[model samples]
Target: MDAADAMAYLFSPQGRVDPYPAYERLRAHGPVVEIAPGLYVATGYAAIDEVLRDPRYEVTHEELTQHPVAGWAESPAVASLTGSMLRANPPDHGRMRQLVAGAFTPRRVAAMRDVVTAQATALVAEMARRGRDGATLDVMDEFAYPLPIGVICALLGVPEADREAFRGWTVDFAAVLEPEISDAELAVADRGAVALRDYFRDLVEARRRAPADDLTTALVQAHDAEAGRLTGDELLANLVILLAAGFETTTNLLGNGLVVLLRHPRHAAALRDDPALAGEYVEELLRIDSPVQVTSRKATVPVTPGGVPVPAGGRVLLLLGAGNRDPERFAEPSRFDPTRPHNQPLSFGGGPHYCLGAALARLEAQVAFPLLLRELPGLALAGEPRHRTRLTLRGYATLPVTVDADQHHRVVVPVPAGERGTPTGAGSGTP
Candidate 1:
């Protein structure tokens, strides 16, 4: 198929489960190819990296709002949430990022390792208990999805009772991140945005009156200190941004990571043997199947990426997952090698807008994966997995697995063998 036709196929639902072949076709056409008017797609490592790091390429919400795309930029709710740092460029992005950076410091995230591990352990234990009678387990529901959401909710001071309500918001907000959308989907996204804003508005007020030792409280303090810096609306929007960005993205990572490991039994076996390799495994997973597949930037000046000229005001979509598998940068790029050195994938992105919660996400994975492998020895896909409909934040809608009795026996207590027990530099954010 031609590049355009291939890209169309890449976005088709039939291709959602496996887009690698389509990506290869697009990459072969050129590192940078114009997908449509004012839109360019970059696939190769060099081009994707350059675009990500280029200052002239901006991520302004206004750009998205002005785009002809339906639902995403057009929806009022989507526009409000995207106005956060994720879509801001330069100074504004820098300001919002700095405000939240202290909580996501390497020291802070490192300190969270224990809490993350404990959560994963409990979830896996529950799964084992529930599946004891040969009952199939939905990994996404039982483990992968809830782990990150629960952690993020705890960090944000969201009550467990209210989690179910917020989970719907998470799904709604995530729909806006896609390249394509429908009117019905936009309405759902709008409802999600409104529900989330109302929920956080009350929560923020409660935190203001009775401040807690949580990120929400910190954000409140930050807003008060820098009065004109962040409006009340901005504060709510930022919180929604954090919830949507933090929860859904990490869910994909965990789900995709497990899928990759299951497909590569040797790597899964190695992880089961040496838990310390969890860090390496997380990096490999990020490269092999990045959760955040595509990020867009608007060019401020005419520039050339991989010999393709992009005019000022042009939109550039960086295919991060495709770049992670570029053979020119990674030897045998398609292979899943946990031990691969210098495996710097564009999964967490780069440059000024690099993901602020990356450290926390990595910490979550480092703690979650090893504990999962140790807890569920015979864990295997229960059935054919189903991918989510969204193309941008590529992930599975459901991942069902079956765990055996041996896996059930592994989670009898809080302390697993060889586990340090103590939270390592708990919440220190050292990395």
Candidate 2:
């Protein structure tokens, strides 16, 4: 297919299954291709990297608000989403990022290592119990979903009991990120946004009254009257942002990583042999198939990406998945090599708006993957893994697998009294 066809396929349902070939086709056409009126897609690594890190490129929040589509601008989900750093620009973005920066410091993330280990261990132990003797289990629900959610909820001081309800709210909240969400989905998204906003409001008030040693408490108690750093609206919006973005990235990372390992049995065995290589293996897995596929930025002034000038306010869709596998940047880009040198993928993005919780996501994957491999050595796919119908966020909706510890390590553990059986539904990703 030609460039236009490839670009079209990249956004199509079939493309979501595997977009790498389409990406290569588009990149061969040009570094930057105008897919539609005032809409460009950057295919190559250098062009995408430049566009993402350039100061002249801005977020599309203002344009979105001015030109509402699907009536999302009037929806509560859009309101909550646009109020945070993801869509913010300039002074507001800087201020909002600074306020939460303290809570996600290296020291803070490092301190959560034990927590991540314990959670991963508990989940794996439970999965072992459920899937013993080759019994089938959905890895996405039992292991990948709960590990990150539990960690994020604990950090945010969200009550453990309410996480089940949060899963439904988060799925709707995340629909706001879709490029073409239907009216029916918009209604669900609005309800979720309003519910999430109100929930955080009560939580914020509670934290203010009874300060605790958690990120929520830190945010609620944090104030500089002289500097005027945090406002009530900003606080609520950011709290919602944290709740979604915090867990979403890691959840997809864990799910995607496991799928890759399953496909490459040799690599899985290697990782199981040496768990310390998880850091490298996770990076390669992220590059081979990014969790967040596409992100956009508007031109604040005339700027040229790949020598193609984009006028002010023109939107540029940065195909992060394409850039990650660009031949110019990565040799044999399609091959999944954990030992690939100089592997700098744009999975977490770059520049001013780089993901704030990147380190935490990395930490989660590093801790969880090894634990999973070591505990379930005979783990293998039981059926076809199903992908979620989303372009922005890519992950498995269901990862059915069976564990046979007859030849490998055996983990026969009893499930806790309160958490014995499987959850009812598949989990969702936010942000």
Candidate 3:
């Protein structure tokens, strides 16, 4: 396909299933290809990287957001999103991020190692048990969705019993982010946004009355102005986005990572044999198949990215997936080789607007993947994998899989983070 055709194809259902080939087609044209007047799509690593880190290339803040998502003010989903740091620029973004950054510090994420281990183990073991008889299990439903949701819930101080409700809310909140949305979908997303907003409001009040050792309580303190600088609206919007975004990225990462590993059993075997290698493997997996595929930025002044001049007020859609596989940056771009030196993927984005929970998401993948490979010894795909029809938040909706009946995994013992290099005794049914 030509560059324009390739760009249009990205919004097609077929393109959404697998867009790498199309991305390559776009790359063949140039690093950045303008599909419309004052608008461009950056398919090369260098170009997208430059724009992402450049202050001149700004995110669409609330005032600018209306230009694209018209009627955003009336939509609850769009309002919640535009209010959060996700849409904030500079000073406001910095202030809000600082207030919540404490929750995801290195020490904090490291402390959650035990929590992730236990949650992933329990979920994987449960899948093993259900599939012990060669019964097909949708691993996406059984493992991928639950593990990340559980972890995010744990982080937000959400009680385990109340975690089930977030799934639907997440689906609703996420719908508004896709490449296309119908009126019905928009309505659903609005309801979902309102529900999430109200839920967090109640949650904040509860935290105020009976403070807990979770991020919610900390945010409450910040919102009340006694400890930090958050407004009540800021607290509500952030809480809604945090819980929704916190799980969304990791959920897609795990789902996409599994499909990659299952297709390349050799690499999966290697990871299982040496869990210590999971860190590098996860990076490669992320590079090969990014979860958040597209992000756009508007120009504040006339500037060039990848030698292509963008006039003032111009916009560029950063094709992150394409950038990750740019041949100029990565040798044999499409190949999934963890041994590549200096693997720097844009999966989590870059610069000021980079994902705040990036480290936490990486940790979740690193811990969960090895545990899965080791525990499910003979795990394999049982049927065609189903892809979620989303160009932005791309991943599998269902992955039919089964394990060797005789080798089904037993309950997992929580493995401490420091001891990851050592084997956790997978087949022996002991941690």
Candidate 4:
């Protein structure tokens, strides 16, 4: 297939489940190819990496606002969302990122290890309990989805009771990110944004009245009275972005990681034998199947990537997932080797816009995977998995798994006064 044909197939719903073949075709074309009149696509590792790190490339909301697309970047709702750091350039992006960087320090993420472990363990236990009567478990519902949502909710001081509504809002908001979205989808996104604004408005008011020790409160306090670092709309847009990006991306990571492991039984067995192998497994999973597949940047000046020239004011789509599996950069890129060396994946894009939640996502996966192996040794897919109807943020809508309860004993660990406990006793079980 040519570049344009490949782009069409890659963004189509049918390709959501597996876009590798299309990605391979795109990469084979060249380092960069114009998919359309003003759009360029980069699939090679070097090309994608260069664009991600290049100072000439910018991610501005103005590009979206100016686009003629019906569903994406065309109204007041889109304008309100431009306040977020993801849509801002240099100084604004730098300042917003720095303000939140302190909260995601290595020490802070390390300290959250116990919390992640406990949350994953609890979810597994609950899944086991619910499945005790021979019921099949939906991995997405039982484990992958809830864990990150709970974690982000706790971090943001959002109540657990509000999680369901928040999840709906997240779904609608994320739908707007896909390429070639429909007007119906945009209307849903608009409604979601309005609802979220109202929700955060009340949340901020409450925090103002009774300051709490959470990220939301910190963000509120960070806004100096005279300087006005963030306005009410900006805070709401950011909170919405955080809630959606934080939960949805990590949820997909865990789901995709597990799918990869199951397909490569050897890797899964290795992880079972050595729980410490989780760090490597997580990294390899990120390389093989990243949650965020595509990221876009607008060229401020004419630039050449992979020897292909991109004109100024043009849009460049970086296929991060494709770059992660480029044969030039990785030996046997298609193979899912847990122990791959020099595995610097572009899963988390490079430069200033790199994912702020990378550390937390890694911690969640590191804790979740081992606990899953321990809880259900014979955990296997019950049926074919279904992918979410999203091209940008790829993930499973449902993953049915059957747990062989007879092969493993259920272990209950206590939640300490201030912390949570880890699972104990590692042994072999029938696969």
Candidate 5:
């Protein structure tokens, strides 16, 4: 396919299913290619990296509003989205980010390791119970989806019962991020935006009344030494961003990682033998099939990403999925190699707009992968996996897998005298 055809395919259902072949075509064209009259796409590693880190390339509310969907101008989704740090620039972005940064500290994220492990283990055990008779378990719905939601909701002080409701709300709100959503989808997203805002308003009010050690309380009560506190809208909007971002990406990560491991049983066994390799394995999984496929930035002034001029105010969709697979940056980019050296995939982006929850997301994946593999040794795909109909977030909506309690009984060493409990579902693998 020609560069134009390849770029066009990205918006088509076929391309959404698997865009790597199209990415190769675009890369073959050049570092960057003008996909449309005013829009461009960056496919090369160095080119995408430069664009992500470039100060001249930025996200702005004004740019996001341009050529928006049919009813987006007056939609509540637009109102909430426009106030978020995701679309802001300069002073506003810097100030809000600083407030959030204080709460999402490394120490705070590291504290969730035990929480993640416990949640994953419980889910795997539940799967074993349901699948004991050789029934297929929908791992995505039962395991992958709930882990991050439980973790993030707990961290944000959101009640356990409300987490499921938020899942539906997030699914609706996600349509706002798409490029060509319909009027009907916009209406659904509008209602979702309103519902989310109302829910957060009450939560923020409660936090104000009596603050706690959770991130929500920190954000609600945060005060900059000079910049003052976040406005009502700012606080509410960012809370929504945190809630949505906190879980959505990590959910995809867990699902995608499991799919890869199931495809390569040796790697799964390696991780089962020694869970320490999870950190490295997670990184490679992210590089090969990133949860977030693309992000856009606008040119503030006339500039060039790959020696091709982009007029001021023009938009460039940075193909992060394509960039991660650029042969120039990674040898045998398509191959999944866990032990790869100096692997710096732009999965979380870079520069000022980098994802604030990156560390937390990484932590969850690192903790969850090991638990799933160790707890379910015979975990294998039971049916055809179904990917979500989403262009940006690539993940399975349903992953059917069967687990064998007996298969998980493989032991490398003699079980300790007192440590050997009945291998009902926990199995004898203690690694």
Candidate 6:
């Protein structure tokens, strides 16, 4: 397909399912190519890196979205999301980000290691139990989604029983996040956003009434700090953002990583034997097939990315997935090599707005993958994998997998007595 056709197809429902070939074609046009009148796409790694590190580029704020749906400004969800640190620029972004960073501390993440491992162990056990009779199981529903959800809920002080309710609400809320949205999808997003906003508001009030030792309580304390560091809308919006992001991306990571493992059983065995290798494996896994594929930015003034001019207010869709696979950046980019040296993917973005939950997300995958392979020795894809129909957040909706206790791959090795135990899963983020 030509550049225009490629861009159009990338966002189409069918093309969105697998946009790798289109990405390769876009890069052939140049690092940054104008796909539409005022919209450009950055496919090359260097181009994306430069645009990300440049202060001239800013996140596409609500004003730049140009959503023609009536009453978009009145949307509580949109208002909350846009007001949050994620999309805000400069002073406001810095302020809210500081407060959030203070609450979401490194110590908090360190403490979750035990919680994550326990959760992963239990979930893997449940998967083994359910599929012991040779029954097919949706790993996305049973394993991938639950691990991160359980972890984030625990971190936020949410009740365990209330975990399942978020599945539909988050799914509905994610509609507005797509590259394009229909009026019907907008309506669904609005309703879901309203529900989420109210839920967080109620939770905040409860935390205020009786403080607890969780991220929510920590944020509540931060919000109550002197000088009014975080506004009420900022608090609610970030709460929704945190909850939504905490599990969604990790769910994708787990699902995507599992597919990679099942496809290449040797790597799974390597990780199972020496769990420490998970860090390297996860990095490669993300580089080859990232969880979050696209993010947008608008030029505040005339600027150029990869020597391509972008007028003021011009929008650029950064194809992160494409950048990860750029042949210029990676030798035989299509090949998945876990032992690659000096490997770093633009999966989480760069500069001031880098994903705060990045380290935590890596830790979760690192810990979860080893145990998953060891525990479910005969796990295999039972049916065709079904992907979530969106380019922004690329992942599987239903990964049909079966645990074959009898048929074992040569790669499934027995772990040492001292090295064996239930594993873990936890964390959240954008990429």
Best by lDDT: 3
Instruction: After the best TM-score superposition of candidate 2, give how far the Cα of residue 270 lies from its true spot, in angstroms.
Output: 1.2
For candidate 1, write residues 67-176 as lDDT tens digits: 35555546757666566778776677788888788888888888888888788888989987888776778888898788998999988999988887777777886777
Cα displacement (angstroms), candidate 4, residue 396, comes to: 0.3
Compared with the true structure, all predictions reach lDDT values of: 0.79, 0.80, 0.81, 0.78, 0.79, 0.80
Query: What residue runs in model 1 are displaced by over 4 Å at the alpha carbon?
Result: 62-74, 405-431
**For residues 84-179, what per-residue lDDT tens digits would candidate 6 score against the true structure?**
887889988898788667545688777778888999999999999998877889999988899999988887888888889887888788777776
lDDT of 2 by residue, 1-431 (tens): 77667876776777776677788888987889877677788988899889889999988853321235577558888888788888899898998898789878999999999999999999999988888766778988898779888998998999999887777788778877765566786798888888998999999888878888788787777652434677777778888889888887788888888877776666677778888788888898789889888788899898889998788978888889889988889876776678778888999989999998999999999998888889987787777778887777778888888877563332323222321222211111110
* Tens digit per residue, CA lDDT, model 4, 1-431: 78878877876777766788889889888878887777888889999999999999999454332235565545534754577887789888887777677777889989999888888888998987877665678899888889999999888899889887877777777766665566777788788777777888798888999999888888888774536677666677777777878898999999988876665545577787788988978998899888988888999999998888888988888888889988899876776666678788998889888989999999999888878877877777666777887777888999877676563342222221211122112321112
Residue ranges of candidate 4 with Cα displaced over 4 Å: 62-67, 71-77, 405-431
Provide the TM-score for each candidate, comma-separated: 0.90, 0.90, 0.90, 0.91, 0.90, 0.91
What does each candidate score in C-alpha RMSD? 7.4, 8.0, 6.7, 7.1, 7.6, 6.6
TM-score of 2: 0.90
Clashing pairs for model 5 are none
Off by over 4 Å in 5: 62-68, 223-228, 405-431
Could you tell which candidate, 3 or 6, scores higher by TM-score? 6
Steric clashes per prediction: 13, 0, 0, 0, 0, 1
lDDT of 5: 0.79
Residue pairs clashing in model 2 are none
Candidate 5: residue 188 Cα off by (Å): 2.8
* Best candidate (score: TM-score): 6
What does the lDDT come to for candidate 2?
0.80
